[model samples]
Target chain A: MKKMLLFVVLSMTIFMAACGSNDAEGSSEATETEDGKQIVTFWHAMGGASQEALDKIVASYNESQDEVEVRAEFQGTYDEALTKFHSVAGTDSAPTMIQVFEIGTMSMVNSGHIEPIQKFIDEDGYDMGHLEENIVNYYKIDDQFYSMPFNSSTPVMFYNKDAFEEAGLDPENPPQTFEEVEAASKAIVESNPEMKGFALQAYGWLFEQLLANQGALLLNEDNGRSGVATEIGFTEEQGKSIFEWVERMNTDGTFANYGTNGDNMLAGFLAEDVSMFLQSSANSRDLIDNAPFEVGVAFLPHPENVEREGVVIGGASLWMSEGKEEAEQKAAWDFMKYLQSPEIQAQWHTDTGYFAINPAAYEEELAVEMHEENPQLKVTVEQLQATNPSYATQGAVMDMIPEERKIIETALESVFNGGDVDTTYQTAIEQLNAAIETANKARGE
Target chain B: MTNMTAVITQEDQALFVRTKRKQRYKQFIKGILFLLPSIALFSVFLFYPLLRTIYLSFFLTDASGATTVFVGWDNFVTLFQSTIFQQSIKSTFLFVLYTVPLTIVISLFLAIIANEKLKGIGFFRTIFSSTMGISVAAASVFWLYLFHPTIGFLNIIMDTFGLEKVGWLTDPSWALIAVAVTTIWMNIGFTFLILLGGLQSIDKYLYESADVDGAGYFYKLRRITIPMLSPTLFFVVTVTIINAFQTFGQVDILTQGGPQNATNLMVYSIYREAFTNYQFGSASAQAIILFIIILLMTIIQFKLGERKVHYQ
Candidate 1:
């Protein structure tokens, strides 16, 4: 009898241990509101200062009204957040709103699980005229917004003004063209033997931007708007030119290849190992804060012969999940609307280096003052405005963009390793097209 | 009277049999109850996920992990045909080859040195075992700093020696070696601790006998120590091979299987395929393939290696 009792106790202990983990699942589910206010959950990928900005925005929105309480949770990095969203999708426990990166836009659209922001806008008769066209164009498919643009950024040239001055190059006049950059880099390398003249992350985003600036589409069928991109549109000439430039710069001992890691390139710039680099304007604030010397910002350089059209946007946007309760959806939309307000956006832009999606945000007194004090922030806005809105500049909208970017990065690595540029680019395009085809077929598009 | 006595003894025998049966049943129940927790945990965590992975390998899934279409063996066929997958397999083998033996030899050497009764032996043992506490992510980040081409301490030493600065993590030729070095460094602590324990447990009389026989240090190390240490070495080799086959964190953090997929090990590829590309089916198929390969290798290791391991 005693042995049986001990057995039961052991079994009970095991069961209890198993049940312990389920406790965490309790807080994960959307809680029933005790008060009259609707509680809306938000899952975001922002971290550090960006997360702080998000919390501040949420706090302000909560304080402004008692109808809704926004509970913002940091899910992790963009990839991790998307993974979490996908894991919880189609389940009752999914958050009311989720932030997805630019690359995930098409995937979210195709999943048919999103409550398109256009529906809320149409029902509420909200005006989107204040939103920047270039930024809005990215999220719009079939001339309708699927997700609300939250944090947007465009790529530009970042240079060390102190390094430039020390290299006997004009700090105010940063390189605007590839030939000019090459010449200046040569001068910098010669004048300051310790400094590398130029460096760029071996990343596909910069390559895509460079293609966009050349008035070229990265994919076919009007960057996959008219129809799914059946093939990559980066022609051999365009691809080779970009590859050969990197090769030549490397050979000239003027350009440092940071090997596909963005952090390494950022570190090189901060340490003054490189005089200039091409990085996202969103990192402008970080660069400014970390660099010991004065940093110079300029528009990304184009080829000497190619006209500089503009760069595409990089960053994430806010998306609403489907099958959520009406009140939660309404609360989410209200929170999104609050986020898009001029004052809030201006504050976000000043706090984080992300560009304000609403053009009117620049008119905010704080934004204007902040830009005056740090004119480097203004360069990104000018660069965005300078872009001629077109199918090419709108960037690719393929579902396999992340994989495509990785392929291009690998191809770039091969070229840097002295592989033939033409063959490498061709092979990369072929592989990318195969991947896109697979994705399209899987989606039954 | 004797017949009546016999009848009583038979009844007693039957009663004794019944009581023993009841006790055996109770013990059986208790044993099962004790094992139920582990069984349940294993089924939920290990067996179910493994079976699910195999099942999912046959279907192409979308970004949300919902099945879109049945791809059959297409994922496997495609993976087998792809050059990148082929390169990843090659790289994984290269990594195992570079790390496993070197880890064993170096750790064994450290263990032998540490086994000696010397001054500050405890301090040396602590210093050797300290790396075991570091998480892979932390260690990889530290290695990244040390490998930074321009301002890294390694480069500082290279500059002092008038040697050219090598892009340890950037250059494709060196990236794999750099990651292997990091893995070896991180693994040495655990391997050293195991081997140290093994060395301490070795009979002192064997060495004393060898000393009386006029066996030199190297001769005794070869004849006495190695044969005695085979069991520990076998365990270390098996664990190291399995661990090396499953390497992901260092490759992910330090090299990201890049500079031309030089460090693209199997696990990292699986992660990239599933998480980055959202190709769950392909990732699963790749995972199953990795599982089979690791299983076969481990089986071969046990079959061939166990015979050589001396059991005193």
Candidate 2:
């Protein structure tokens, strides 16, 4: 009886602990209210040192305004933030501002959950010339802006200098073309049998980049817009080249298939065992700080057969929720304009190694003066400017992109696991088109 | 007659005092009513959400949050049509099929060895049960690093001995088996303890009687030990099957149901549908299917227990 009683007590304690509220714990004290001050909640998903820089900027913004207060909250990862936002947006109380990813912008805009930023710009009479040309264009739906562009980044090649020198290759001159990259990878493996030659995000993000460089359209008819209902053609002739390369790497033991986590490539690169890895430009700050050996940045490799095309932007943007009161809407506008300010944009770029969408900030006298000392800040801009603009290579706006990505990742997995690359790619195209159709129908697009 | 009446009155007075003491004990318990607030909290926080989920399985949500059209059987119909959903259900059942029997047989074997009256018996018990302390997420992460094809420790050992590295998590054929191996390593300890306890609880007199009847070790184990341990074995089998069906944490952490959906169990697919794709309606229907499976399994267990289990 005593043992049973003890067991019951222990089980109850465990259950209560699981049920206990260890919630947000209220970190900030209530600010002293003054006349005309409105507190605006802003939920974002940035963390680590990047979050610290954001917090400092928010503090400065609050100090600058006696009429508005912006309180930035750190929500969990990107997916969690979206889930939380949906849950809270229906209530009487919801955040006035949110940091949504670029992929989510089209869905949110179509859902009518957010207001058009073009309306805010016209109402407030903000100077259009103050923003960058490409930056302002990034938030367009039918050529009308809906969100304020914030953090912008593109993919680039990051390589280990030590590994290059060890393989009898020039560290200063990284691979500039696809053929050179393949050759370098083979050389690196032979030089060091213990090390892997190449690694990439298991998802088809890398494959998309390869297709873009080849100047091929992945999906037809403007990639699933109402005017153009083109089926997926990534399994066609040009796409076969990429799959063939994947197979060659897998069978030759040069390419290591990391499970479908982005961290796999980052971990392998940081360990200095992989000679070359492809990742986002936003990792520049982290790589500079944490890499044991010297790291170099270069433009994404292009094929020798054709000219390179523009790669789509992969970072996030800010969206303002609809159904907010006039006061809250005005507060959201103020915060949006504040983020797009030249000074803040430049600071954001320098702090996090993400690209500043305001191209003027890159060449303005003060910015130019600052850049003369640090030339590495110019790589993303150079990479972006040297490409031809085409819709097939432009940013994709497909509904159910997440599901599409799952199909691509599965295809890549099959290719890396010694399956027939042609069959896998064909199967992926068929699967993804079906998903796109389903999502488009559900969304009433 | 007067003396007898006086004695009866005294005895009645004593009985009245004992009854009064019992009433005081009841009042003492009532005085501890401050704990009602906590009980109310648990009922609201934990039990309420569970009941709400079961209730919510009947509804549906569209892409936009504003529209919640409750089509009772539509979601289930769509879910049943999905090839991926069907595959996940099949995979989950296969996981249970592979894990439960293997776990029971291995644990029972280990328990029998540990239950032997020998030197260092306590050490063996502690060593066998230590794996219960590792969380599923932590163990999956460790296994991921261990099985990484190129830079992993396992591959390094394989290279040393001139063996080709196996694609443990990447190959579709091997991914589910890899996950099962990690789960088996982590959970076998807890099942071992239950079986060991059951083994110890058997009355020694039966074994002594069997020995006097000239029974060998295997015969004693079969006739004397197996029947007596049937109840505990039944409980372990039911719990193991339920746990194997709900194997989400490892799949989420280690594989994410990739390599062409080889490791995609129903729970992980449900999570992807709900959280990743925001298809809450379909996800809820998948969850309902999982609930029905578990309910049927439980009923089957109970029915089987009534027939096969012997009390003595």
Candidate 3:
């Protein structure tokens, strides 16, 4: 009986420990070396080639400094990194400074756990004017700089020039309208029986880009720039046009559904399973190096009825923690300025396909040589410059945009699976409105 | 003389009752002493968090998981009406049905086959249980390559055979099956090991006695082998069911509950609600519902299935 009792106690303890850990707290002190230099932990979401480039930059920054050392920790994707930030926000476990995506701008501001970059800019007399105008427009809202813009990208359509020549279509001028893209897809299919013509990944970012290209807003109240958005902002025609375009290609037997996985879609294009896709220009370097065939980059397509607008900026920026040592914040500010220098920005722009936020980086030899070798790299910049400065092009600002994105992705997947477009669109609108209302209510206090 | 005798008997009865009460109180104190440590741990970890979840379910929460507004029963009511939540419930049940029985039967079959007195049987046993050591994340990522749409070997095989290529993880009907198949493959290793241990423990004397009585192999297996393994089977069934209901890792790594929410099991939905959407109130409500479900399932199994479980 005594042995049995001991066994029971052991098993109960094991079960108790199986339950998840409470967020650990109690340490609010910052770390300092014996040499009296502060350590600034910088969390980021850049992976692959960009990660390597960032590490090199940090190494250089540390080598050049003596008062503070910055540690760059690569957190997972943007969504995952943001989720982790929220769990440890306002605690000592949080990073001294972190990178946040463009869509998370509003949420990070509302989180009340970050010190606005405007404070440091004012004290340091930093000139935010040297950055690219289009990139600056997306980050600067309500006449204030909440974060320092780092990497920025826009959506552009990639086509197979070899496939175009084979299909008897013009290789120099790619399709610039949705109707022309549909026609091109049909022609490509006619020429190659084994390969599909087009693939639109069931991704939310591409869906948002398509809407912006049609000059449609994502939320009401001036895309939430003027005030908090209350409901859906785009009209029925603007939203349904995107659905109908995909449906037509799908009907023509020219559409390939890669369903929510971008890597798979990219792989399909490289394998010659699909001939065309719309992807971020951030992938330009990798795609050009990997594709076995000639690749061409063009502006994002719009519907034939509406005049062509431009794409929204898709990337991340750096923001400092709300309460940290003044010395640490100053060190981070210095690092941010270092990151925007011509040499570092040129290296970043060349290594990663994210266009340089610092325009002066374009004049650097590294950037100039990369553009000359891969001329397709210039198309993303041209597209960004062409965008009319409006609320729609500036992109929506909301705390619930991530939730809104999931809703849109689900609807797109349904349409790709042959569900009725009208029903899918209707369901998406209802869910999005409900999410916005709930978000507002959560912030009611 | 009669009254004097009656009073003496009543006094003796009163004395006996007093001693019995004292003995009962002493035993109760001893029992409490044995249970003190377990009770302390349970209160700190299990009971506190469970009660906290229940409290959070009745109020809305902000992004940092703080309670912002009070709305009684609203979270539960909204979950019931929400189509996405409804789809998640249906898919979870479907996934459980697809994975549980196949895992048990396949493992049991492997155990029986490897129980023979053949040469090098131990090698086969080790091979059968090899998947037990593979972590869930590694296993899911490996399966992801096999299910890749364009480059996966499975689709290539289908193409060679001239069959219509199936979207293993992209189609609504196939994504759950793909995940279920991956789960069954992962589970067979541990389940096979347990069942094989039970098989090895069964007494050989009974089989010899059956052979002396001219019993056939099928008859002996039907009559003797099954009844002896009942306890082990009962345990494996309960654990597998609970594990199936709590599946989150493979789904997160493989699908993230995509392809029109066809693979959005309850746990993944709760994760998305709480972490990604930052809707803690509704997430807590879902967690509570999942807990009640697993609780009722275990209770029902013990009540109905325990009778047939034979123990030595």
Candidate 4:
């Protein structure tokens, strides 16, 4: 019995030792050679096709310069990457640079752990004239860029051309306003009783975009840019109209409620269960490739009475971490600058359907070829260019944006379930404001 | 001569006492040495985190998990007052109610059927036990495909039966039931295996005696099988209840506590608080409350169930 006990104890110790060996090794120290070359780590949330493009760009940059050897790592999705960044912010394991999504911009700015890209731009006397004005406006705070916009996209309407033709609607003339969308949807439903006219995931981003298209603020204090917003502005007339329209659509059987799953909604559209849908421009490639019928692309519909304002960007940006060695920071900036170059941006745009942040990328041969092959790719650029840069169009900046988005999503779900719109929005707004206040208190802001 | 004998007896007694104490000391050292690793591991992974969670529940924390200020009982107070948290508790209990009894009934039925002496019983047993081999994530994904509203197998079957297609995931009324169905399916393999073991271990004599008396199958089952299986049923019930309370993956993957928070289980609420909202203090408080609730539930189950378990 004693021998058996001894053996069991030894085996357990060995098992624990084996388990201990699997922990990740500590971060490597940043070292600079006499030639001014430094090693930097760049963490990003790009995955799948986007990840391939990011890898290619990183590889090319590594081959192009001897000054910086960037080791790019894919760190899951944007939320996951930000969570990891928060966990390791003060630790040595924190990446020298990280990509943060648009919603996380406020959090990153308030984090105080980042070196603003504006500082590097000013130090290098780099001209920002080539960058798209509207895209750059998103990451800018108080006329200074907090991070560099990498891949930017705006929401647009995608329709099935075959469905439109079959429904006897003009394929070339898609719905340009909410009223027109309703009319066209009615016609489609009457003609084809089997298919729904439209479908969209109950995503908060779409609601935000719709509000922006109507030139309305989603949060107070000029969309939380001039001051910290204490309340949501989504209880305004435009917000109510948007909700009423969705509720009406659902009631009329003109809208397919796909819940909040974007992929499932996309599948519904691709399978032609719905004639039209609204999704990010980044899905252009997928629709063009995988869609069974010709995919028609158009600007997102606005309310008939309200003039259309341009949509806010939905992708993420690259932010450099603070407290790193100056050489490493500079190396990270060089990679960011490399990413924004016209050739690389064009390739990125072509590879992933994300709109290139550099307007000059449109002039690149690859981008021109891509547009020639599929003109829908050019519509996103035109739509962005037409956007009037204003506080509302810049999108909301709030530390509690994620929570607020969740609240809006919940409100939408409730409204869909025949809940009173005014009551739902009021309750949601109150809850959101309370949450914001609590977060501010927690942060001691 | 008497004094010499007394001194000899005292010396012998002293020797015996010393040897007994030495043996006990050796045994104590050996036992402690054997348990040291487990104690260390438990302290590091379990006990320390539990203590820290309790400590954190009283303080407000920043996004990076740094404590900013001491809030005393504010976190717990806010959680108790929040309607969402209350709804989550109700939803969790509803899920437990939906899954536990159904899982017990279905698995018990299968176990009895598979317990019969029939040809290819092993194949049928393997078929019923296959889900245990599937991971929660894989199973949830499979269920997601099967539960898709428009192009799913379930809806297709409903269509074939001339039934209206119910939005299994989208509809608020059906979402929780859909998730419960997936969970019940996932749990049956485990519960079935345990019950089958219990079924097989019953002495053949009792059933043989019942057969000689011309007792019906139902009579024999009620009199012999159920009583004999009571202990195993008790264990399965306890385990299933605990597992049901901690259901997170299916709700997260399927509904994300949505369709108006109809499926927001308590554990999912804790996850959202800590990870999504970065409210560690509130999350820790919720976790402690959940721990208490589970503890109370298990205690009640044991109290009510142990007496009914026939150990013979």
Write model 2 residue lDDT over A226-329, tens digit each, in one string: 34343664537677777776677666777767757666677778877687877778777777678898887888876667677766666787878777777877
lDDT of 4 by residue, B25-93 (tens): 988978987787788889989999999999999987877777888899999889988888898999899
DockQ values, each candidate: 0.53, 0.28, 0.54, 0.49
lDDT of 3 at B29: 64
A88-183, model 4: which lDDT tens digit per residue? Answer: 886778899999889998888877788889999999999887888887677778889889889888899999888899888999989999888888
Q: For model 2, state the Cα shift of residue A79 in Å.
A: 2.8
Global CA lDDT of candidate 4, please?
A: 0.87
Ranking by lDDT: 3, 1, 4, 2
Which segments of model 3 are wrong by more than 4 Å? Answer: A1-30, A34-36, B1-16
Which candidate tops DockQ?
3
lDDT of 1 by residue, A1-445 (tens): 6876787778778787768867666546645467877888899998876788889989999999989999999998787898788888867778899999988899888878889999999999999888998887888889889999999988889998987887788899999998888898999899888889888787888999998898888888998889878888777777677888888887898988778878878888888889988988878887887889999999989888988898888888999999988988999999999999999999999887889999899999989999988999999999999998988888889778888888988998887777777788778877988898888877754
Evaluated with TM-score, which candidate comes out highest?
3
Chain A superposition TM-score per model? 0.92, 0.86, 0.93, 0.90
Model 4: residues with Cα > 4 Å off, grouped in runs: A1-41, A59-72, A323-331, B1-36, B205-214
Model 3 lDDT, residue B126, Cα: 96
Better of 1 and 2 by TM-score: 1
TM-scores for all candidates: the values are 0.91, 0.80, 0.95, 0.90
Can you write out model 2's per-residue Cα lDDT over B166-260, one digit (the tens) per residue?
Answer: 77888888889888988888889899999999999999999999989999999988988889999899889889999998999999888899877
Candidate 2 reaches a DockQ of 0.28
Q: What is the lDDT of residue A167 in candidate 3?
A: 98
